[model samples]
Target: MPSPEPDDLKRLAERIDEAERKHAQRKKPPPPTSLGIAFRFATEMVSALLVGGGLGWGIDWAFDHWSHLQTRPWGMVVMFVLGAAAGIRNVMAAAKELNAEMAAKDLEK
Candidate 1:
């Protein structure tokens, strides 16, 4: 068999270097998005508030619509307060969850 030329050896050396570089490289995962986390947090907080208010309104309607019943918007007012509390609670929970996730990621690194 004929020996390889100088040009061929140079090309082979370049290919080996390229292969070694690729072998030494590691794949990095993409970071989690803050927008998505914020959206979920907001959604949880808002939905809790909305659902609480809605249920309160429903109770108020039931009381008013019944015969021989006289109740002011007190149900709505009370429910509104409860809903606000629930929203606050949900927001706190979301914050805790996010913090935990971040802590876990830091530990990973």
Candidate 2:
């Protein structure tokens, strides 16, 4: 078989280079979005607050009835305060997550 001509080799090289450039351009994926992060954070915070508050209320009821009648009032107050703290913590965590997500999105673009 005859060897390929220089012109044919050059054309083939150009075609290969073009293909590689196009592939590189197409392979790049879009950056992550913050909307998904925000939604997830809000969902988690709301769920945690609800579950924590319910558990706190239940424990307070049980303690008031069975375990320690003497400390019932204080226990109830403490439990309620703890529940509130948990809720506040959830909110703060969500806020932090949102801030981080926003920062990440900004950096991406």
Candidate 3:
């Protein structure tokens, strides 16, 4: 067989490059599904709430043990409210971070 010309070789190389680009794209992983997103959001929110509530309970117990001043469940109630607020704040911050990360990844594609 006759040797291929330089022009033919160049065209072949171009075709190979294009094919490789396409192959790489196909190999890329798919984005997370709706269910996965929902699970992550739920996990983040619930974990924050639990931690906050636990802290509130701990605070109330510590105050009960103190002998200097009389106290009731008021401390527990207030701390619980504060804990809930903190949980909400944490969840919001986490959601914002996740959204930014997703945006960055999307831009990469």
Estimate every model's Cα lDDT from 0 to 1. 0.83, 0.69, 0.74
Any idea what lDDT model 3 has? 0.74
lDDT of 1: 0.83
| Tens digits of per-residue lDDT for model 3, 9-103 | 89999999999998887444566777887787777667766776677667767777866544456666776677677767876886797788789
TM-score of candidate 2 against the unseen true structure? 0.48
Better model by TM-score, 2 or 3? 3
Off-target runs (Cα >4 Å) in candidate 3 are 1-4, 12-30
Clash pairs for candidate 3:
none
TM-score of each model, in listed order: 0.65, 0.48, 0.62
In candidate 2, residue 12 scores what lDDT?
96
Q: Write the per-residue lDDT of candidate 2 for residues 1-109, one digit (tens) a residue.
A: 8887999989999999999988887344454467866676667666766665666667667877787555545555665667667766877886786678678768867
- Pairs that clash in candidate 1: none
The best candidate by lDDT is 1
After superposition, which runs of candidate 2 have C-alpha atoms over 4 Å from their true positions?
Answer: 1-53, 68-73
Give residue 30's error in model 1 in angstroms.
7.1
Q: What lDDT score is found at residue 80 in candidate 3? A: 66
* Residue-level lDDT tens digits of model 1 in 1-109: 8776999989999999999999998875566698987888789878978887788888888888884565557777788789888988888988897788788779978
Q: Which regions of candidate 1 are displaced past 4 Å?
A: 1-31
RMSD of 1: 6.8
